[model samples]
Target: MDEEKKGTVHYKGAEGGWGSVRGITETWMREVDRPGALRTLERQNKPGGFMCVSCAWTKPAHPHAFEFCENGAKATLWDLTSRRCTPQVLGRHRVSELKTWRDHDLEQLGRLTHPMRYDAATDSYVACSWQEAFEGIGRELRAIDPGSAVFYTSGRASLETAYLFQLFARLYGHNNLPDSSNMCHETTSVALKKLIGVPVGTSVLSDFHHCDAIFFFGQNTGTNSPRMLHPLKEAVERGVKIVTFNPIRERGLEVFRDPQSPAEMLHLKKPTLISHQYLQVRAGGDIAAITGLIKHILAAEEKLWAEEQRHVLDVDFLEQHTEGFEALKAHVAGVGWDAIEAESGLSRADLEAAAQVYVEAKNTIVMYGMGLTQQVHGFENLAMIVNLLLLKGNIGREGTGCSPVRGHSNVQGQRTVGISEKPELVPLDTLAELFGFDPPRDKGLNTVEACEKILSGEVKAFIGLGGNFVRAVPEREKMEAAWTRLRLTVQIATKLNRSHLINGQVAYLLPCLSRTEVDEQASGPQTVTMEDSLSCIHGSVAHNKPASEHLLSEPAIVAGIAKATLPPNPKVQWDEWVADYGRVRDLIEQTYPDEFAQFNERLFTPGGFYRGNAARDRVWKTESGKAEFTVPDHLSAAGFEDAPGRYRLMTLRSNDQFNTTIYGYSDRLRGIEGTRDVLLMHPDEIAAAGLKEGQVVGLKTDAGDGIHREVGGLTVTPFLLPRGCVASYYPEMNALVPLSHHDQESKTPAAKAVPVRIVT
Candidate 1:
């Protein structure tokens, strides 16, 4: 709110170290139980304690004393906040008044302490009993056609909770299960499953140990998953080559000093350089950049074979373990360097140099994140990454694979246990026999389709296991409008979010427990299971006290709703599942017997058991019986880069934020402090647009649909990026991404590549 402060301050320190410590201290002090918070933090990622409630990075076999990072600490203490959003606390503010509040301020109101329902006449939420809430939700579900309802889950839920949540929806007569993955990594799932036979990332944490070279694309690892800095730093210190391709110069890939390392924390000069070479590729230019890499690689392979009777590519590996090599190589050869340079915003020389790193390294691991996945050609982008790795036989080997750095805990696990839109992924026959009811066989609506259905009056009921749904979606304004039009809306949450204020005709804010807090049922203290981003399964038990006596665990809430909505069935024991979460795991193992074999016994393993990747063992479950090299007709999403007088606007997150949750206004590493309304642009572009630094401007996106998509009041701050690219924080910039502007196959919103113009 300060007119004088531009909110962009130059940062000169290492990624972690003191900056990380300060972050932890800020959140720790906010807890009423400061010492209790410290005690809770100590329990993170330990055998008997709960897993870190933030990022889904795996716990090491030999864990560290401090297993949490800056973001993880914030997520933990956020749940342990002293402030409580009780009935008396909430009643003081009207719905109209709360709507005007900032997303940060709304969450700072603290955890929801009781079940609350909207009072339409008063325009406020009043306290209601859990029983009353469930009964009302049941009545609404029964009234509406089951086809007109959706069950949405955030990545925050445990595997046990996601399983039951999906079951409740299916038994109620639909498979309309949409989740955060539908927005983030759905492209990875759709692409990888088709190419490699497995949907999840191939690399586990151990893969970093043996990797000779690692290529990172589009992911800002430092902020998204600070804990990942440890492995990357270790890899660098030991002389592993790291190459990065991103539109913006993300601080995470530059330098870092792990706070957990005593030697580094005590010395400012001990910062570890992360990337050997950083490429500023344009947003949505992954397709071009990767294609260019392949082009260089193919040229090298031909020269080597012709001149020296040698091979630059893994000729034997490709012959034995892969298919479509000749076709893919031919496709790469056809793409000219000029087009690659123009589209990628990188020179041919840079691509050649990076290609040399790839060819020279014995074992390489390639990783990408939402930036590549959240694009118009998202599915194609992922397929290309796989194609690149396959050329080197980078998969199904030690330290050689394709890795998707996932956001939030259990997001991947949720899909693994059946939170899916695709009907075929769910074992309908098995579920039918197990639950004594017929499971829906039709394909369900994804997030994008869910929004359209809601707007079209086809969807009347909605349920969210966790997350601020309306706030995280594209064309947020339209979705928020349709959200209020729903016949019923239910949110099982730990905190009050913007979605809570946007009430439906019948809205219920069902308070639920954070994973870090104790979850007790009839059997005793329950320990739920979480599958890390890379398919490692582990159990966690809360050590901290519950936020509220009235709040229920996510599993309990799902079971409660199932009981209220479904007719009494002897086969599906909702009460038993709630009382003992392990019962849910038993059912999950029955559904996925191989992956979850000996579920209960192996769950509590010291570092958790790896569910294993079939592709890692050179077992391709694909129809081809081999890893397929998918060749696209050409590079993907080409028109955006060539469009004159326009910039590719990417929606990003601040260091202090996770997903849609904003911890504060500071992004210390990027020199951002006190504001989230700033736009990151190159200095040359700022001058070219006739816009001075620190000047407020507006960005408008013309999707050619007659709908005006614009965001104003952005303070233009100069930063490193491609000439035609610009960046802004998410949720604020969600307006720029039209709902229709998404991948045709995956339906993942192209948040990284919305074409826009700066208007003075």
Candidate 2:
């Protein structure tokens, strides 16, 4: 390697240089060691030990071995590494010095060994005991109006922990639970809630095996969920037509060499999983492209009906199970071909081609992620996709449905077990009946709402269960300012990060046992339940030791805080529940009896269980008892109405990352070996703008909130993205995201479609 390349360091690498990096190699080696400090803890068979802290995607109960992904390994290394974040050590470092460290460096500093309170007087943090931390939080929280407290939960919080958190918040007389899901898949929930009734993903892992054609739009399965590689590869072998619609070409989408495949592993090669038809659709233009596909499908159906007397849509199913077809048809008719082509950057021919593929396949599945969900009209964009699938009667079938890929393993699970601050009338009523108290009827704040409340001085306390909430929110200035205004900020996490540094007036950083650590109670080794991407709920008992003696499981932490904060709250036995997680599960069973039946018995099963819902059989959970189509309107409206030099930019997670967890700086598929600073753009556009490859340039957007921030030192690279779309890594460019810029219905920031221009 060249000297420059050897010394190179950037935001986070975009591509495959994981093996050669010294720091990463050391971490990997440390991860493999057993019998030593790393191995001593990793090999023990205890509840809550050695859970992959990366993406919430889980393996189907393999023989007690290394069941973690690369990102998961990094998360484990982060918790168990030799680094320590002692109060005195951190106190020595100034706020500016701490701020100077990279996001990766801050997190790499090992476990927060003691509860620490950020002391603004000395501009440093000081050690505090668990009692002191809890008492401080309780005192501050008690002083604030209950409605002014914002409780944030990450997917990493176990089902027990999440339930107790909601209980604590409700008992405290508020429902302001902001979570990571709002930033990722809130659009899917909003669209599905209005159309199909269910606010969660319905697609099962088994559906991947049955689907005759899988249309993966706006998602990179390899980077997001590595475990998906096996199923996709199997589908290809069975002749399932795989189609991908993404701006950049991802290697995992093209082909994957499964290490588990003995034959392929011995050959040192991988099988191809490329899309039979690849469409590099423009960012924010997904709705137009989907609408065009639907139009083509309708056209083909009409032709088939005229000649062969065959209907493309399932007339029986449509008549029995859906409504609003006429309105949807009218909207589709109004969408002109010229507008579709111009907005989506795909020709009518490409739309027709994709439609033909969908039409020919017997069982089709459509999977998408933040790419489709983080747009201005994201909710409507998802509705159109559902409309396309529904036109062909694709949903609620043996092998056809929409799959919204959530980032965390138990994110959907979190919503399932009552992590939601937004209470549906039915659930709230049910909870009231079960718990003997009137649950808060008012809708709670989402991520954006929480920030707005915090900024306006309405929210005085911000308590996070387990996420980098400050870093995760957009427009850092407003968010940071609001956080500092809070009287109390508390984080219950396995390791320290930027969230701890950006403290409120009285902040406490409480370190807890990681998933890989032993979680014990009176019943001996305990097991926690997690929900996977496919809605499969299962038990996970760790086979490892605790990282440190002081560490506690998420459930224990929640219980501890609840014990200290709640003023003899009714309907919840915080101490008893903490004694054993099963009690929490029992309470959950009562609260959501329809889903978690025989919770204890079923959880013992190897794969745990699936929360059964009739919606899987196409029963619309909507108010009218039927799935409804939404009218597509102005998906690319921002682009058309905007002025010149405004390009739609999408922020993406690198292959080496999972949300805010940056393991290293490498993206294998994009061929970005060791840098995240390079922006992916069309060579033509870069050259036209008088910018050369590897040259740093500033980028500003004209999206409603007037975000004209400069992102200098950005290296440009030529990629296969559509002309109107450009790509950059997230958190780095997260500052460019305006807080006011969000989906109308879902309130999710349009991180994928901000209009911007390159500056000198």
Clashing pairs in 1: none
Off by over 4 Å in 2: 1-26, 30-51, 61-67, 266-270, 433-436, 569-571, 635-642, 704-708
- By TM-score, the best candidate is 1
Per-residue alpha-carbon lDDT of candidate 2 for residues 69-185, written as tens digits (9 for 90 to 100):
445555556555666667666777877578878887777666677777878888888877788877878878788788888889988777878887887888777888778888888
Query: Per-residue lDDT for 1-760 in model 1, tens only?
Result: 1121243344667788899899878877865555778888888887777888788888877878988889998998899898999999999999889999999999988989999999999999999999999899999999888999999999989999999999999999988999999999998898899899999999878889999999999899989998888889889989999999988777778888878777888894578989999998988788889999898888888898999999888888899989898998878878888988988889999999999999889899999998889988888889899999998889988888999988988898999999998998888888988988888899999999999999898999999999999999999778888788888999889888988888889999999888888888999999898888888988998977888899899998898888999999999999999998889999999999988999988877877899989999989989899999988754655234446678888898989899999999888888888999988887788888888889999999856678888899999998877878889999889988899989767998889889888877
Cα shift from native, residue 587, model 1 (Å) = 1.0
- TM accuracy, model 2: 0.93
Residue 637's lDDT in candidate 1: 55
- The Cα error of candidate 2 at residue 732, in Å, is 1.3
Alpha-carbon RMSD of each model: 2.6, 4.0
Work out the TM-score per prediction: 0.98, 0.93
Task: Name the lDDT value of residue 462 in candidate 2.
Answer: 85
